[model samples]
Target chain A: MNSAHSDIDRVPMQLVQGCLVASVQVELSPEVLHVFQQDLLEAVRRTRARATVLDLSGVSILDSRDFRSIERTLEMASLLGAQPLLVGIRPGIAASLSELGAQCAGFAAFSTLERALEHLDSAG
Target chain B: MIELGTMQIRDEEAPVQIRVKVLGLLVSLGADEVLATRVATAASELSHRYQLLGAESRCRCVLHNEYSSLLVEFRFTSAHPHPETTDLEGIAGVMRMGRNGTGTDELVVQIKLPMPRDGLSKRAIARGRERILQRSRRELMDELRAKNAELEAYNETLEETVAERTRELTHANEQMARDLSAGSEYVQGLIPDPIEEPVRVDWRYIPSSSLGGDTIGYHWIDDDHLALYLIDVTGHGLDSALLAVTVMNVLRAGSLAGVDMVDPDRVLFALNNSFQAHHHGMKFFTIWYGVYQPSTRELVWSGGGHHPSILISPGTEAPAMLEATGPLIGAVEDMDFPAERCTVAPGSRMAIFSDGVFEIIRDNDLVWTWEGLVEFVDTLRGAKVPLADALLQEAERIKGDASFDDDVSIIEAVFP
Candidate 1:
């Protein structure tokens, strides 16, 4: 199993400076992706965070399917009262997405998690 | 130098005939297949370009037997000024623009191939040329008769093979599991191969012993129309597969009388009247039938209680779902399966699949929904993995194993 999920039912979400931050670290199986979606939405609803920063620095195999899943998740999270902030996108992943003509033009992305948090903080 | 007579490019078939002549010449001279094909392609392109220069244009092909190599030259002449080296896409060897600064509309192209150890004698060259000449009427009739006889023998053999396989399955019914093991190749032979030209089509089919009777096929309805469909009959095992194949044959042959099967909705209506569940072995089928018109770039589709097919747009816009909501075929007679039409832009893609493509049981013991499939495929635009393989892989991932409980069929067509 190429599942990055350490636990089946749990998805780790942390809060820092009144914002929720979750860093994706490995290739996620379909089950893990579903679980992550559920857990992220629940955390957003519970903490009522203004911004949620998702870091993708550790995920190297970012294929189109995963990229699209992340894109949908971001839109869903935004609808759930949390401004979704994507950060830590590797250069290779970005280049691949553009090369394959993936729809990356709709969202604004950041180079680092701290930069994302700083933007959120300054916006506030 | 053997001056092979020049032929006029009267129509589209002229270039093809010219290609055949050059190919035959090089192949007879011991040129390798690759080199022969390249030189033939270059000759055909050069001649085709000459034809395009207006009605007063023509090309002559000459074969020059040299000491070390066989040199082929295409001498092109036209009343219209030859523009910029007769654009052959730089396909072959040495291309000389024109004649001795005469500024005449003549573009000469030369291609060389290494000569065989023993060069052909004059008599042998003439013999080869004779062999490559167009066949006489009597010769064509003789070839046609031979081909027809061969086809009849092949059909008889195929029938015997199918009959023998069926008998073995029926006799080993008590040992059904063992007999079913040999059915993988038998089922594979019924599926169509991937098509590349006119319209690019590819599909993935995975059959488990417990999940049979899913068939996907496409055929030209006319010179400009193509019919694409996926049919899934009820139940499992060899009986259901036979039924599916029967229905596919019916569709492929367009044998449903009194109705034009080329129209998608009409085909469904006719099928409903023909294969009712209660009357026909308690089996009903769900099918998504669509027709593609290359001339109009239109796709008209209708379904009998099957899942909606997805049409991915050309650009980054979200995909349009072609909803199909009629009742299952054979479940109800005279069911009006309404058809809808949409224009397919260049670079668009269509994915018509059975329910098994998206309706997988997840690890959480929940069946996947069409919405999940929509979102998944939406991201699959510009995906690294091929569409059919990617869908199957994702289904296996969701199910936690490679074994599928139902037939997994995905047919993808890309319009360029």
Candidate 2:
């Protein structure tokens, strides 16, 4: 915890007119992932949001377990009744994740944040 | 005219006393401190210049009150050689120096000034002489003490400055220690917990007492396949730690592109291509990666400039060395790392370690090489402590301390 000050900084969360967006940065360490889960869920419950987007545009490198944790967090957000959408998965990462046989079939992923927001708005 | 003073300028202190007497005489004649000091400066300069010639000179002061002006004269005579007196004019305003005779060493320096409102009298001249004679030795000692006090104050200031700088340096050292310890803890956290269900696995890693990067871990690539890896970056500190972390993450997650996640050879090849030395500050790393299958009890392993691991079991008479040689990852691209496979017999034990474990100085001041380490591992039969812990303890004991110069890392897995 002492040397992890900079890494433990909060995941940037924004509430966009009833939709919550949590931006993910690089270095998906376990401590950061834990904080990410706590921060995203707390933000979702507090806002009573209709849509939730976990932005992965900033992240270029992720491991298998970190990917699993991200997907599981998204699922939990859906259970809380918010429509969860993952946006901006890098093409290189997408290819590697698919090759590694990670379960990405159930995730609602989009190529861009704009497309994800449009889908969420249309669904409402 | 009144004869103010006369004394032989015998040494350095005489000229100083002469100058003061001249100042007292001027002040007694109704001159202010500034006027008195100006005359005193002239007297002091003339006496000092004559003293430097190493000649015994006699100085006499005479004051004269004329119609509207007063004259102060210093008459000097030396039995030995004398210095030229032309520069005396600059020191004494309205003053001039002249030789008493063409072939003699006698010279007279005279300064002319406006007479005071009141004419000079015997009473005033007598008062100046009495006060001059009354100046005692204690007053001189008091003056010296004042100067010494000033020097002591400056010395105290210097001592305080040194103390402040020392405190700042100590603080910086403490900060560095805290940061390094925190980094060590974080890297240690990257290792996955020991496996219990399929096989009993444990490890010991002591990062260089300072901060160096040495990483080891075992994780399941899938339900049936388990992946294990150990990495040693070339250098130490922050860059090495970051590279170690990134590499371990890529290996544990099987996150490299076109990498058949279960194949040890493909993983090494991909890592070599992705992290060529030129792209990474010319840094290289050694790695031992293996994939273990529980159903078959077979381990597929590859190496890149890393030490070979050891496999020993109750049934085998001799310990088997699992050796795989390839160019160091990031050293040569397109390196074809040969994969080696070995089936684990029942109750077999596999041991893997970083170079720091074996490359240590013993009590005989000789380095224990890989062969020596292999021989030592072969003898650890029925040891009270587990093999991994025993190896670490032995390494520390041989080195005479736990603070190794390199990161000491060892992983031992007992097959079910």
Candidate 3:
């Protein structure tokens, strides 16, 4: 029998200067996305991270369902008292999302990781 | 206990007398108002039909209270023997037709009424039965008149509600049409006029909806280079059109700080950095940007998630499709778009278009592919018909319709 935990690809996250920096490098299936949300929220609780930055530079295709997941993640972070920021969205992905009326309402978006970090640092 | 009553119908007034007796029995049985009215109505109809046969008609009604239920059985007989049971409308009871043992035809109707939850005393039942029997015909007629007025008022209210909802829906539809028309006009105004310079340029645009997202424009960056671009934003309608117009305005203004407008790769890179998908309502677009150097007769181009521009040079039998240099723009960060160079000789022509031009459904229910577009263009290479008009005609022929499912935009540049 295959083990229940055989193929779980956890999203890579790090703690930097009292903040949680989670980088999503792989295409997130629905199941994996749900697991990621649970794990990220648990990590935030454990580290008591002051801020959260989701680096989505690698995501090329984003549909309405994916945007909904991202919205839920941002909402979760805010509920946990962590300021969430998004960085590194490609132009083509932006066009597709904008066409669907997906607005970055709760989170701030930056073109580069460095810029996003700089903004977070200065704001803090 | 069971009680039986018999009536012989000899004239028109006999049916009414029987109907009053049925109502009295129902009230004594403690049946609800609606059930009592329905049972009485059924009894009247059966007796009336028997009287119309013009024969000796007799109706036998038996009322019994058993196992907390009121059971009323109506047995109707006529001398004609062929008693038609046609007046059973709106009766919520069981009925049976059978011949009696006395060589006579009979129609039997059985109505069962469950005892009310609040059981009535024997005295109350007797009093109710007495009250119904005491009411005159005038009072009964007045009660029927009141019920008709109530039903008419209810029907009027229902009709008025339907009319108000239809008016609201029509108004909303008209408002939407006006908004769409205004949006289409604004998008049309954003398209640049044809430029007659070292390079001749003309284009065509058609939106499946009132607003389109396909935008094409070309302008001279300097004396050395002419910058040309075609962009197709995802989806259609007002949001897509607005994003396409925003990108066009930025490119026209040359407002990206420290970016070289004449360089194809730099232009795409700057656009990607500015319109990151997450920042601009999570929207992304495909762009093909190229710069033509008249001095060198070289066309240097770069594309981000966009189909390559088609180049047709002198003495070449087929058009060359310049492949994409990098990934689609606005999705990833710090992406590099490499430029590809091709020299254009005199009398050569080049075309840049959105994917909608080739991905159309033809009359045969097949998609018009890039190869099909190339073959169509080949036929109109040297013809007197303009390139934009020729492509539009081909699209119409393939679609067999005037409208498309997506926004179609095509730009044609002819080198003199």
Candidate 4:
């Protein structure tokens, strides 16, 4: 297991049933998110799965650009016929995201990768 | 009829002869060669004027360099023979010359041959000799001290010169250090880290030193489209770093115009045009650019004299290189970018890297080919990975843990 520098960086791809499950350890900083936007879009294209579970466990903070990048990724994933499910939203980030009106309700949210997988499995 | 009293040879002598003899005596007490010669000539001439019979006299003197002291000898012969003759004198008045000390360097005695037994003449000669000696000693000491003081002044000047030279060298070194620090900061400022976004794009930029020639930037065309670019100026350090900044600024301005083939190609044209216009004639850059549309999963890319990009598909064991269709930017004006499009399926990866990655040599062999990079990406295909970590590790592994020889910048666009 690559000990990710952050909790939100998704390097080790784990497949859960039909869902592409990844624990993303990201800095949640603007610079990381800018790149994350493109990186996630490409990661989804390669997984060949319709659903994704994102673990934001490593992100200690989230800026406006990061919030925007994730929103854009979710939109792109939807266009690609895959749904992006966010997990490991530390309560602080959850509040920040909600306060920013990030419009994340369009995608699924979970507290952990396992729970997210369970949700995906149940929904499917 | 001037009797000239010298027949007495100052019976003793006449006043003129005595004065001249005294001056000669002073010379003998250690006056310089020129002064001693002049004194002796005056004494001889004075004796001739008197025409004293059998009046024979000689004077010899030695002196030091400063003419401050003198040693003199005086002798006299008289025709009349005296039974009671003595080389002695009685007390005489002291003689002083101007503001200086007593003038004579030494004193001389002449015995009157006409049976004169007076002690006065002996006392006068003895007094003159003593006075002359004291004056000579004082003058010699003063001259020696003056010469020593002049030498000390000269030595002080030499010391000051040495100190000034040392200060100049130290100041120059400090200035050089400051310039290096400023140049380093300028380079760091030129290359920004990857911009963060919610979408999966990750990047890494490492300059070889504090300064580098690599430049990277990204601009959002709208909510769904983005434009990215990287340029590596041709050289290292300050000059190259400045060129990279120039290209970055030009690209940024073009990006602000909105997404169009007209935009990327026009930016390229402006870069080359501006570089040529300057004609300082020593700077140019190799550039690569891509426009990504997340909604369509299409990337329009153009390359100029840069490393080809890697495109990987799910389940594919190799990666494809997007080779340049045009020469490096800044080499021509009004050049066509002719953007290429690649459709990445969900979960595919595209790696954009500088030539610093491919140019690395190991054991005299090129480390890895474009195909090898694609295969590396294929390994990550089944797994969900953040693009930055995977690329950094692979780059480090290929370079054998050696620091990158030049600036290394990599961007991975993951179309999720």
Which of the predicted structures, 1 or 4, would earn the higher TM-score when compared with the native? 1
What lDDT tens digits, residue by residue, belong to model 2 across residues B232-272? 99888867888888899998777898778789999999999
- The CA lDDT at B131 in model 3 is 42
Tens digits of per-residue lDDT, candidate 4, A12-93, equal 4566676666566634433345456666667678777778777788654443335666778777877877778888876645
Predicted candidate 4 versus true structure: per-residue lDDT over B342-364, tens digit per residue? 77777677777777765666777
Q: Judged by lDDT, which candidate is best?
A: 2
- Best-to-worst ranking by TM-score: 2, 3, 1, 4
> What are the chain A TM-scores of the candidates, in order?
0.86, 0.89, 0.92, 0.78
Model 1 lDDT per residue over B190-242, tens place? 77889886889999888865648899999888889989999999888877777
The CAPRI class of candidate 2 is incorrect
Better of 1 and 2 by TM-score: 2
Residue range with the least summed lDDT across 10 consecutive positions in model 1 chain A: A1-10
Query: Clash pairs of candidate 1?
Result: none
* Model 3 agreement with the true structure over B199-315: per-residue lDDT tens digits: 899888887665667788888888888888888887677788788989988888889889988877888888898888888777789999888999999999999998777877767
Worst 10 residues of 1 chain B by lDDT: B83-92
Off by over 4 Å in 1: A1-124, B1-174, B362-364
